[model samples]
Target: MLKNNKSDYMNWIILIGVFVLLLEVLFFNRGVIFSLFISAGMIYLGRKKSAKKKGKILFWGGIVFLCASVFNMMTFKFFLLAILLHFFIKYTSSKKNPNRVSPVLVEPEITKQEETVVVSKPLLDNTIFGQQKTPTGVYEWDDVNIQAGIGDTVIDLSYTVFPKGETVIFIRNIIGNIHILVPYDIEVSVHHSVIAGTTTMLDFHQPKIFNKAFHLKTPGYDHAEQKVKIFTSLVVGNLEVGRI
Candidate 1:
């Protein structure tokens, strides 16, 4: 998966380089047209790769903005200001107080009849931009927390071996796509919060709502000895939970 991510990054870099070179050499006088074409191509490829509903909306919206830019229908300065304002708001909302104490987890009480073993590890605060891939084969972890700012994240647990109990995954994403692959034998549950996003879960049928929250779980999840629970918060992105 890491190798695949590197390859995808390299491909995007090459594509951008080629587009810039073409713009300088052949489309200097018609820069807007070139920009429109490239943006449209990106939108098309993105939709083809994920088929995400929110992604489609974002892409189509970009096309509309590009058209306005090309025709000078709106002030370019106002557009730039709006972009800046968006970033400002995002940055402000994500900020945390430095003096605030972090939460600590307490160990559960164990009875004499049963031995308590800690199988999961705590996940530190980590931020990822672009593409990220987890350890591929036979992966084992107690808990996972991820914050993805953009691009793609793939968590492949199909070949993993889970301990006898429950595992937890928490993910927050903005303008990104998260794909989780689990083994068919394992039970799974998902609780999702979406502010303009979408989620597709295996073996769960529910009407999708825009800018809303939903929960999904496989049958027999509550009684399954080995289970996984995923909690996700997404803003303008896609989340897919599937079996291998």
Candidate 2:
């Protein structure tokens, strides 16, 4: 209840700020919108928990400044500084989602294991968190249709699995790090291309091959095929490969 009251008060403050911005735009039309909107946007963006959102907010801000410039209202010099400020702020935004610093009152998941074939939203959202259980030891972990964030997530998993025939890990855009462990005797093929994480080869009983950031550690050239791919240049965070 105390937290709820705090949230309500903050909202009221934001509302007042928005009202002030509107009044500034009305009364001071020269460069008022630029200053007013930027101020309002900065405060709003400051409270946002997503890095992706900060970009959008900044992007819209650029559009506003660009529009102002095109109309011969604000100088391009002012526009550039305003845009650069927003771009720079995005770099520091999300090491984690702010609202999720602690477990909130989100409703619990009640799905059965059979129904829990995991599907992920943006991964950067409220997805890869809240629970982790011991893997079922039947060697069924490989080829498991696991869905990980394709975007920047506050927290993620590092896993290792070996499949009898084939294996796959579906990654969208994991922000931080990804470490995979495989059986030392299996021949594995990994297919992934992403700029967010650095993939490194590790020494094991198996032979390891790397192409640029693509790495595959194999006992020998079994050519027994299995693969995973992650899209590159994702609007997310970083990734690093390591052993579990």
Candidate 3:
């Protein structure tokens, strides 16, 4: 409840700021209103036509007009700085959390039966930045979570084994590219949320957008004995899933 209240308060503050800015633009800088209208029209046309190139053109043009209306470039610079600072602070804070769990590599355990042998692999929870590649070979894991902040991450599970029922992998990325390689035999499903990015699963492609959510699944995902479910959130990045 307290968190909700705080969020409401912040939203109100933002609304008030927008109201004041609107009043100022209408009274003190009427020329800006015209620029805004033009920008809006361009953006609308671009969206209607599904032309990303046109959208980019008008978006930057709108920013230029908005900056001119606001008097100087300092505000824009400050806004960008604030955004960077916010992400930096958020990243550092997450790393510093006392309850945060660190990832560890585990080897498979072997057990012998009367006439057979069995191997049980450990689950993996990895948080990585920059470029990384998953260990290659046959293995089994229960739950895998990956946090890739930047650069590229390649995960190949072509030869791995999954336990019966649902196995989950969670990924959070920012300004990075993730490529997941899965085998054809196992069922795979992906639930992804992207902001200003692209997601490609097999032959399906999701173009970059302001915000988009995608759910992709292979055949037999629902009733398959062995299934892999991947939940991913990406910001300003790309995610590609392919067969091995």
Candidate 4:
């Protein structure tokens, strides 16, 4: 249920992938069909992740499909798609397109007075309690303190409230995809230097930090900069760097 643990998640993917491959080689000899089923199953299971996450399922699925496809060019579509999409993600991810964008998260600063006064606005919490399924979740952030307990709790921080001036986000145990959204026209500075995950800056450079992870981005040179400073550190998790 808790989807933030990176090691566990990757292990699941790998385990399932290898299992699927073995099944393909032994039982279901439909070429990419095995990979496709495994990937699709994972995606369906992780339907709650995100748009990019869904893509990742397919993406990694494609990676597994490669081995099986080698023997059968009959399913050229799967092979071509896997190679093309994998490279496409790699190319676009590495090349750094200034025009591409990602979701925006508004981390609000809670003054003492504001904290005392409970606003009636909706918050992005991880769970919809009492419901059968949490198709939509909200966030509520008093602060992302480095408490050992809350480390790998994949927060739906889409609606988190962050302090002004400077802040960095951290992940402890789980491998999660931190989805951050910046407002259009807000000159917010961004940085993501964390271990275990890649950083991508949708419209800017990677965050300056000590051994940062993956995928971090902010407004590129084409856009105006903000006065407020924002720093994010995902000690563990995928930093899906982008601005859209």
lDDT of each: 0.69, 0.42, 0.69, 0.44
Model 3 lDDT tens row, 22-121 = 6666675556657655654443343334347776576456546644655543334445555676588768977898465789987859764656667655
Backbone clashes under 3 angstroms, per model: 1, 9, 0, 42
Cα lDDT of model 1 overall?
0.69
Best by TM-score: 3
Q: Which residue pairs of candidate 3 clash?
A: none
Between the candidate structures 2 and 4, which one is better when assessed by TM-score? 2
lDDT of 4 by residue, 1-244 (tens): 3456645855765565567566666676754555545543443334334357675575446445544555553334444555576578768866785556898997869745533666664222332111111113444444333322112233333344445434444333232345555444434455545644445555444443334443323445225432323445543344543443
Write one digit per residue (lDDT tens) for candidate 2, span 1-244: 9689757856765565566546545764556546544543443343233358775566456446645544543333444554576466555554443445666796759855654577643322223532223243432233333334322322212334443454444544333233444444444455555432244434422212122344454455455554332223221233343334
Question: CA lDDT of 186 in candidate 3?
Answer: 81
Q: Would you list the rank order by lDDT, best first?
A: 1, 3, 4, 2
Off by over 4 Å in 4: 1-174, 204-210, 213-228
TM-score of each: 0.50, 0.32, 0.53, 0.29
Residue-level lDDT for 19 in candidate 4: 70
| Weakest ten-residue segment in model 4 by summed lDDT | 126-135
**Model 2 alpha-carbon miss at residue 91, Å:** 42
Question: Which segments of model 3 are wrong by more than 4 Å?
Answer: 1-128, 207-210
